[model samples]
Target: MPRVSFVHPKGESQEVEAAEGSTAMRAALLGGISGITADCGGEASCATCHVYVAEPWIERVGAPGPDEDDMLDFAECERRPSSRLSCQIKITDELDGLVLTLPESQ
Candidate 1:
């Protein structure tokens, strides 16, 4: 399992173990972490799963694809260089200690 950490805009952090192949949004929702709604499930159509990959993990996470990038334009909060849709981030051994910061709105 990979350990994913969700940091709220308020500075709160919650770490949870995510099963392999699961998306970060799924892990957050199932683990009851705040700030990730995942309204469109794990589909790439929604931007509600927006999160910012923390430093050190940014390069490892890579950049979002075309569809993800398009959907991000509709995110409830402002997009940043590190903005990403959690549904597109699949859990893997390489992401063991991935850290994400949730936006203030969603």
Candidate 2:
């Protein structure tokens, strides 16, 4: 399992152990982390699972794929260079200790 950290908009945080090959959104939801909605069920068609990869983890998470990038434009919250859909991020051993920050709104 890989440990992942999620920082709430208000500055609260939680660390969770996630299985390899699972999506970030799923891990968040399972751990009761509210930031990621995963409304489209990780299909890449919905923008509800929006999140920001923490600055240091940005490059490690990499940029969203073309389809995901397109959906991000419609995200309810403001997007940034680090904006990404949690459903699109897969957890791996290499991602152990990955950190993600939640936007105030979805």
- Global fold similarity of model 1 (TM-score): 0.96
Backbone clashes per model, in order? 0, 0
Tens digits of lDDT, candidate 2, 1-106: 9988999999999998888999888899899998677877889887888988988889889999999999999988999999999988999999999998899997
Among all windows of 10 consecutive residues in model 2, the one with the lowest summed lDDT is 33-42
Candidate 1 per-residue C-alpha lDDT over 17-59 given as tens digits, one digit per residue, 9 for 90 to 100: 9999988999999899978888888788879899999989999
Work out the TM-score per prediction: 0.96, 0.95
TM-score of 2: 0.95
lDDT of 1: 0.92
In terms of lDDT, the poorest run of 10 residues in model 1 is 34-43
Residue pairs with backbone overlap in model 2: none
Best by TM-score: 1
What Cα-based lDDT does every candidate model obtain?
A: 0.92, 0.90
